[model samples]
Every structure is written in C-alpha cells, then in structure tokens.
Target chain A: MQVFKVYQQETLKYFHSIAILLFVTVGVSAQTKTDTTETKKKPTSFVPTGVRVGTDLIAIGMTRYVDSYKGWEVNADVDFSRYYLAVDVGSWSRDYDNGAEIYSNNGNYFRIGGDVNFLLKDPDRNMFFLGLRYGRSKFSESLQVNKIDSMWNNNPVNERYSNSNSNGSWFELTTGIRVKIWKVIWMGYTARLKFGLTTNEDGNLIPHDIPGYGRTDKNVAWGFNYQIFVRIPVRRQQ
Target chain B: MEFGLKAVNLSLQPRVSTMKKATWFIFLLIIIASCLNDPDCFRINSNVIGISFRVMGTGKSDTLRMYGVTTQNTDSTFYRNTAATGIGIPLDFTTTESEYLFQTTRGDYSIALKYDVNVQFVSEDCGSKYVLENLETTGHTFDSIRLVSRTPGTTAGGNIEIFRCPRTDTMAVAFRQLTLSGTTKSSQALVVETNGITPDFTGETLYGGEKVSIVYLPVNLDVDKHAMVIDFDQVEGGLRKLDLNYTLTETQRYRPCGVQIFASEMIINAVESQYAFDSVGFVLNETNSSIRSVLDPFDPMINIYRCPDLDIAGIYFRNRQDRADSTVSLKSVTVNFQTTNYAPTEPTTFIRVPLNKSATNTTVTIEYQTGKIETLVLSYTATPITRFRVACSDQNTLFTNLAVVAQGTTLVGSQVPNASLQSIPTRNIEIFP
Candidate 1:
C-alpha cells in the first residue's frame, strides 16, 4: 500500500506539471481571446491550417555512427480537430558480417496512418496519440554462408544467397507523444508494435532483419523513433 | 461547462504521459535486446565403423602381431606387416558388407560384419552422412559374437567387439574337408599332384570325405589359381562329379563370399599334423582348390553370409552323416529359424530372423521329414537369416546330397508338419555316451 501511494504521488506530480503547462497554454489563449474581444472579440479555432514535417533523429544518429545502418526517414502530419493524417517514408540499407555469414539488405518503405489525439483541447496543439499504420517495405537481401570443414581437415567454404526485389507488408499499432518545447518546432517519440508479417524459419531467406521494421525473427516486432519537427502554423482555429 | 471538464481531465494527463514514457523505455530495452541466432558449423557429415578385438584363452595376454584386410581394401591379399589392435576397417560406404581378413601367426581369420548403412541429406551446404544402424557381427573367429550398440550413429564408435581366434594348435596344419560325390568304393584312390594322378604323396584311408591343408595362394591379378588332382576308382563316376560341379557353378553363381572359383580342377595338399601323420586314417591327404568339385569350398556356410552393411542375415543347413566325409541328401528336409520379427523384404532364405538380433536364445530347427540325423554344431548367430524362406513341406522339398555329421552319437530328427509355417518345434532326445 505504501509503495502504491508513493507511485501514485510520483505520477500525480508529473500530471501536475502537465496541468501547469496546460494552464499556461490556456491562459495565453484566453489572454489573446480577451485582447481580441477588446479589439475584435473572437475565440481561437482547433482546425490545423498548416503542415508539420519532421526528420527521424534516431535514424540520423544511427547512419552517422553505425557502419551497417545507412538509413533516412521523414514524417509529415496534417491535423484536423483531434485526428492527424501521418505518413512515414524511409530508405534503409545494411551490410554487416555476422561471424559465420555476411548479410546485406537495401530498400525503401512507407507507413501511412491516422493518429487520434487523446487530449481534445490542448492549447499548443500537442498530441499524445494512439495510431494504426499500414507499413510496406520493398527490399532485396543477400547472405553468404562461410564454413570450415573440420572433419575433412578444415577446408574453407563460401556460399552466396541473394534475392532481388523481394518485399513484405505489416501492420503497426503505435503510440506516440508529440510535445512542443518552443514555437514552430516540436520533438517526440513514437513506439510501434508491428504484426502480420510472414515468419518463415526455413532456408537462407529466413527473414533475419528487415530494413524499415527492424528484425523479422519475432512474432511481433517493435520499433521506436524520436523526431524533431518544424511546424508552419497558418490560420488560427475557432 | 466544457471548460470545467477539460480542466478536470488535465490532472490525469501528466501521469498518463509519464507511464507512456516508462512503457516506451521498457519496450526500447526489449527492442535493443532482440534478434538471436543459431550456431553455424563448417561441416556436418558423419561416417565410420569402429572395430576392436579382445583375444581369448591362453594367448589372450600375448600381443601377437595382427592386422586386417577388408573387401574394401584395394589389395585383399595377405597383410603380413600391418599389425591389428582393434582394426578399424572402413566399410564400403556404399555396400552392406565389411569383411576383413585378419592374418595372424595361426592363420587368416575372416570376420564378416553386417550393418544397415543409412545415409541422410543434411543440407545443401554440408552434403550427406552415412548412419550405421543395427551393427551385428555374424562371422567371427570365436565362440559367440556380441553387439555393444545397435545404432552407433553416423560416426561408428568402438562398440563391436570381435573376440579374436584362440591360438590353439600353432604347429598343427588347419585342414578343410572336401568330398567327392560320384566315386565308387575302391581300395586304391591316389593322392597326387595338381597336374596328374601320380602318387605324389601316399594317402591314408578315412571314413567319409577327404581332408587337406588350407593353402594361402600368392596374390596374382591375372587368373592366379590353386588345384589338386583326385583319381577316383570309377572313371565314369569321376566324370559325373565334373558335371555336378558345373551345375553347382551355374546355380549358386552369386555366392555370398563372392567366390567365383572355377571348380573344374581340385587339389588336396598334405596336412601338417603335430603327431605322426599316423601311417593311417587321415582323409585330408592332399589339399587343392583348383580341380574344383561341388564341395571344393571348405566352409559351405561362407556362401550364405554378406558384409555387415547389408541388412540381411542368411542360413542354409547341410547335414553330414556321422564321421562320414559326404553331405546328407536335402531331399526330405526343411530349415526354419526362430528370431525377432523380420521384414519379409529382407533378402534371406530363413524367415523371421532380424538383421540385428539380441543376445537371446535363437533356435534353428532343421526338420528331417524323411529320417533322423545326428547332432551338429551349427556355427550360426540369430548366429546368422531373409525374405524368401527356405522352408520345406512334404511336397515342395528341395533335393540335395548335402551331408552334415555331428561329431557325436546323439541321433536327432525334426519332423515338420506341412502346416508348420510358424515356429519350428523343439525336440529333446537325451543320449548318454
């Protein structure tokens, strides 16, 4: 009971900070409304009149540091009331040596989805969302198996495997938070749980790693992305 | 108002966001720790048969030098230099036979092994493997054979124990008995050289068949052969023996020991006895394999057995009369074996005998439907059986002058009924000498 209470208290503290931020946003909106009334009395609208575009910071960091990871992604969203239409487009390629085998894959993928903002009336148009995405990747992969015949006196052997233009499609159930720390710029993380991809464990074509959705060796795979965005706000909502 | 409701919902938002971040963090950890792989190997093919020997009797302690030569051995001739510990004879990866000729100071001992060599394709990368299954030794130079393991995997372990031949009479020459079928009862049968019937060595008279010393011929690639000259009393009967030899060659062409000896000429070399040649009573006077008679081969049982890799055991019974040199007629006899349930497809003359038999009591019931016979030591393992049963009913009886004389006085006979297609009936006849 005591631990529960402590946890509840800690949770309540974070909520209080969000409440304080909400009050600041609402207070500014109210002040603007009052000023407009004193001059041209009208309330702000909720409809989004401009687009927000973002680049995945994780992909950028990976590409810069990891020799195998060469990938880039851009995300765009257009909001309408509490719902947003989002599209994630990315291209990735990997070339790595996994001890006994050398694996390489390269392709581009697109994930289009709609996210429903749970906070119906946030002042800064921030979003904490539950989203559903349809993701499809068209990639080709090749792996070469290298082995030594110890019984026959350690003879070295090499076998090459490659598939061109192979593709896969999956569904992602995602949850994300988009928070604005400043004007015209926002940063947040989206965590996705992907499903419905074929899980074949036979042959060299056993999907070891997928480009966009990560490793395909599991029943359900997960992906996470942190993005930095620039928003061009247009007309204010009523 | 709606504004009041929004304010109330705002209090719960921070905790929700905090929890979401924690969940995301945990999921991130899981995502980072995923993707495991199975171990890869360079090679995965297994194939070998391990054979070692344990010497028996007084010479069990003596490390008399030994080595072996297999059918797979390019030169299946004598191995005088290579010593045998437990000779690891590489079976023909393709055949069921892995017979090795182990030549010792005493003589050459032949060990016949049979096993089911099962091969399976592992993968395209690693090729295939030969799995040795049911390793049972039917031919050994000992009292009995025992299998250490039934399935010794793709890599054969040192599980098949070959009890080596006992060093009994090193000074005495080993003799193989051969019979002349169509000769008349005469007083003067000459023991002669291979080319002619001149009395090269005077022979002693014996009860039944003639005996001669075993000859290890020098290896010759181009039709090298051995022979002995036999001069029967009746010239016409000698001619009849020649025809029977020809018939046997044509009929039993696919002999198990792969013996394609031209039985046109025969030889009988002198047997080296430790005692005096005893100016009398020695059938094995002159030994020769060249002037081949129907019974030129000493061990008739040799023709029925195959190498271990073949999953089939065979047995054919030939009863000789007591102390007689000739085989009994196979006219009214039948042979059946009681053993593990055998596949009908196993190529065999005896039915219901498994390729791999346990060290249990296996019975070989030979029914002499027409008459009784004497006791014979069947050097057989479960001591060796097939698909087509070599069974005998009263009507479908096979006729052969096959004689086997037990070196004892206990007369035995097996009377198998026509409907006796199942287990052979056991007989208990005690005869005290």
Candidate 2:
C-alpha cells in the first residue's frame, strides 16, 4: 500500500521516464534474445550482478564547512540488466538566526526509486542515467521570537513555538553520470529538480527546513550531489 | 527467448582523455551554484482590507462621517470622526476571524471576516511574518455587501464594496446674501449664528449654537407640511419661523434600494421679519424637486436670502512690503462717536465700523499699542434696490463708490481697492501704519 501510494503520487512526474524505461527494457531484452539464439547457450537471466555503495561528497563537505548545515547522505544501487534500483538515506539539521527569530530543525529522510542506464555498452561500465525518486522526511522544528506589535497597544510578546513531529513527502526528477575512475572506485554527479513538496505540519510553527529538502518556502528546489562510490561485485558479470 | 544479466567482469575503467568536457562540467556546476539564493526579507502583502462605500440605487461613491471604528473583543479605536468614501481596515492575524464595528452618523454597522493566516520564514534579519489569505465575509449588518477580491494586498481600489440606501427625508438649505455689481446682481453664502433650530411639532433641536451657511434638515415622512423655528442672534425678533410644503411620491425605482420618497412641487414660506430673512426661494430642481442620491445628498435645494448690511465696512492693516494683512495691538476704536475699547492682550488686523447711512461720510479713530491715535473719514453712496421676491418684493441698500481720507497715519498710508461694500467681510480699506 505504501508503494502504491508513492507510485500514485509520482505517476505524473514519471510519465516521460516510464516511457523511456519501457523502450530501453524492451530493446535490451531483444538484444539478449538475439545473443542467445546465435550462441545456442542458456538464455540470459535478468538477475542482479553487482551493487554500488556511495556517500555524497557535497553533503559531507557542507556538514564540515557550512555553519547552518549539518547533514550526510548515503547512496546505494543494485543492477538488474540495464535497470538499477537506487536507495538513499540521510539526516540533516539546520540552525537559522535571522536576527529577529531563532529557528532550528532536524530530521532523517530516505529516497527510494529506480534508475535506467542509457550507457549500456560502455566498456568501463560507466553510467549516464535518468531516474525518479520518492523522498520522505520526518522532521521537528522550533522557533523563538520576541515580537512587539505596535498596532495592538505596543505590547511585547516573547514566545517559543514548536512542531514536535512533522513529516513531508516530495518527488525528484534526477539525471546523472557515473564513471569508473580506478579499480573498484567510481565517481558520479547527480543533478535533481525536486518539486511537489507536501508537509503534515499544520501547527503555528511551520517547518522551516526539511531533512532531505533544504527549505519549505520554495515550491520547487534544486539539488546537486557529487559522490564517490565502491563497486561490490555480487556475481560475475558475463 | 530469455534475457539474463551479463557475466563479464567489469573491472577498472579507463579515464576519458578530453579535458574540455571535464572543464565544461565544472563550469556548469559553478553556474548552478551561483543560481541558488537565500530568500529576501520583504513583505508584499498587506493585512488590511480595503472597503469602498457605494450607494444602493446610484452605484456612486458616497461619504459617511464615522464616529469611530472598533473591533470585537478589543477596545482599541482604529478610526475616529473620519469622513471618507473608502477606508482600509486591519484584520487580526492571530485569530481566524474578526468582527469590526463602524459607528457612523447615518447608522451603525458591523462586519465579520474570516481568513487563513499562513506564517512564512523570510530570513534571519527579517524573521517570520503572517500572510493572511482566503478572506471571506462571514457575516455583516449592512444593507448590501460584496467581496470584490478574495485576497487583500497593497493595491488600488477596494477588496469590498459596501452599499447603503439613499436618504430620502433630508433637504439642504443655504443662507445667502445678495450683492449687486452695477446692475449684474449675484449672491454670496451667508453664515449665521443660531441659538438653536428645532422642528415646531417635534421640538427636536436639529442645530445648536453653530455658524453654517448650509444645513441639512430632516423632514417628516408622514406629513407634507414641515415647520422649523430658527432662533438667530437678533435682539428683538430673533425667533424666525419657516414652513415648507411639498408632495411626496413613493416609487419602487430600484428593487434592492426599495421604495424611495421623492418630494416635488416644493414651496417655502417665511414669516415677515426684517431680523429673520429678507426673502426665501427654491434654488435647484424647483419644479420637480426630489432626492437625487446619497452621493449628492448635501446639494442645496433652498436659498434663504438676507439683505446685505450697508452700514458696516471693514478696515484692515496691511504690510508695507508684502501687502499682506498685518496684526497689531490696539487700544480703542471710535467710529461715528461710538468708542470701543480693546484689551492690550487682544491683537487684531481687521475691524468692522458702522458707517453713517443717512450721511455719505463717517469719522473713525484708532489708537495703537504705542498710544498713537489716527483718524480716518470713510465715504460711500447707499442706494436702495429690489433684491429678491419671496411673498412680497424685498428692498436692500447697496453701498458703492467708497473713498477714504487718512490723517496722522504716516507709515505707508491707506487705500480702498474694493470701492463697493459687501455683507461678507472684505478689505474695503487697507491701512499701512
């Protein structure tokens, strides 16, 4: 049911991706069938061969350098033929002080989806892919403000508002390239156009920033991640 | 046919030799990074809802004098004694609903509004602000109300238009003084001091102790005859009586505005008294007089004429360089053997002197703060003329061809630019001393 729910939310966003995915899948299947008929051997089985585990270098660098940001993301993918199932997990926290108010938020998030590799014939097994991701974040936020309303009799108000448990869901249209550098080490960059963000925090203190998503103010957000990965061979690729 | 994963071992990869592609990718990353920006701390929305007052029948903008405007559950008065055709009222951002009460001279009204308040984070320097949206008028006590816009912002026009029925029972009366400039006669507005004016039958004081040239008087809806007792500042015959007779026709012109009472074939009558008025007549729409609309509710319909005072003339001191009226402390002023003393604390630039009507000349003496006395002789010709016709022909004197002779006033002398004297005060003689 959760998977169905995620698919229902992502159907319109993944319309073009789904069409390309079907075309690539059918073409790859036809090629495999031709290879089997010519060799007269056992047919190709669309089973996982290897898995790539990676960490986002940009998130790590921001956590170390940016005072307002503290977060890290781990990305992993497993391949079946030319299609790869991708998963990402991360945690983020922010402390923002715009002089008049102090706002802070922290949470964990995870994104799970699939990627279709276009570079199927690359000798080095490099990848140039377009993918779709369903991202969800569980967050909590608080704000401290000293507000003085001059229109309402010049009364000074000192208040602290918080949303203890808030969660949000979003969609991302992602495109990236992954290239093998040396040995099992790989390098890649993913550019994401994140949009359609919906949050469950209806309280007075709205969530200023989400865990995976940077801020809730913008309708559409952009994200870029440069990652270094290690290829772990599950089965020998033949 | 069956498809399976490749069994080939994908090992170490060869590096691309093109440095241009790598440089282009790095440059693209730099451009995308430059595009990311922090939100600015500026507010583009307003918390106040704009309201325009319109008449029900005419759909024209109308003004109403507001005594005060206050909100429910709050004691703060945001507006007081303001006359406007439109106004901007603030909504409470803390609550989802607010009720505003407007106390006006015409009537009292209340409007309750409901909206959603969304709080958004601006920046670290600006903090969070509440954005009010989905504005709806839940309830109101006006004759008509319409929401022109759902969201309120800093914009022109109004978010709402409030309409009210036209006043059909009020009539404006103006007091006028007649003047003649060589056979071409004109009239100027005359403001009078009144003790009180009351409806004869109801004994309700419509006006009290005020000087006004025009007054809006409320008439009876049931009766065709209306009488009012106007007590003036006159000594002997100050209590003047005036009667109005009109035919009221009830017609359903606009369904939303309901039936309107139109007064027509109006006739005005006054008691014969020199101290009250010289004559009285209808000013506008005399044949088919009716209530136009609330927009022009104060249009004068009747003109009560008073004879001009020819015995009085104004004398003002003038600045030598700028030719402007200059104020001076005075000791006393004697005109035509009548001496009036003024306190040293009271400074004046102008004084009214009673000229001799029988004789063509009058003697005036003025003592300044320095105890220097100056004498002047004023001359004018008073001719009688038929001013206006009410029940009978009225006659009034016109003072013209004015001349002034000054003695012992040495500063810059005096000049009489306005040779013709008028009831309304004017600089007939400008004395530089």
Q: For each candidate, C-alpha RMSD in Å?
A: 23.9, 14.7
lDDT, model 1, position B94: 46
Which CAPRI category fits model 2? incorrect
TM-score of 2: 0.50
Q: Candidate 1 on B1-433: residue-level lDDT in tens? A: 3554222233435534554654455354534433221212232223456555554322132243554354533344434566555544445434456666666665666767777654332223333334556667777664334577665533446666655433211111122212111221112222221221221123422212432222212111123242222222222122101101121122223322233432323233433332111122223324522223323212221111101111222333223345222222322222224333332332222222222234332233333324554333222223222321221111121112212224234444422212111122111111211
Give the per-residue lDDT digits (tens) of candidate 2, residues A76-156: 999887788999999998898866678888899999998887555555677767789999999988888777766655556
Error of 2 at B201 (Å): 21
**Looking at candidate 1, what is the lDDT of residue A72?**
96
Worst 10 residues of 1 chain B by lDDT: B239-248
Q: Which portions of model 1 miss their true places by more than 4 Å?
A: A1-48, A98-100, A151-156, A199-204, B1-433
lDDT of 2 by residue, B297-414 (tens): 4578778776655556788888998989899988878776565542235788888777766678888888887988888888888776665434224335677898885455464567
Q: How big is the RMSD of model 2?
A: 14.7
Which candidate should be chosen as best, given TM-score against the real structure? 2
Q: Which regions of candidate 2 deviate over 4 angstroms?
A: A1-45, B1-36, B44-46, B52-88, B94-118, B133-141, B146-161, B166-433
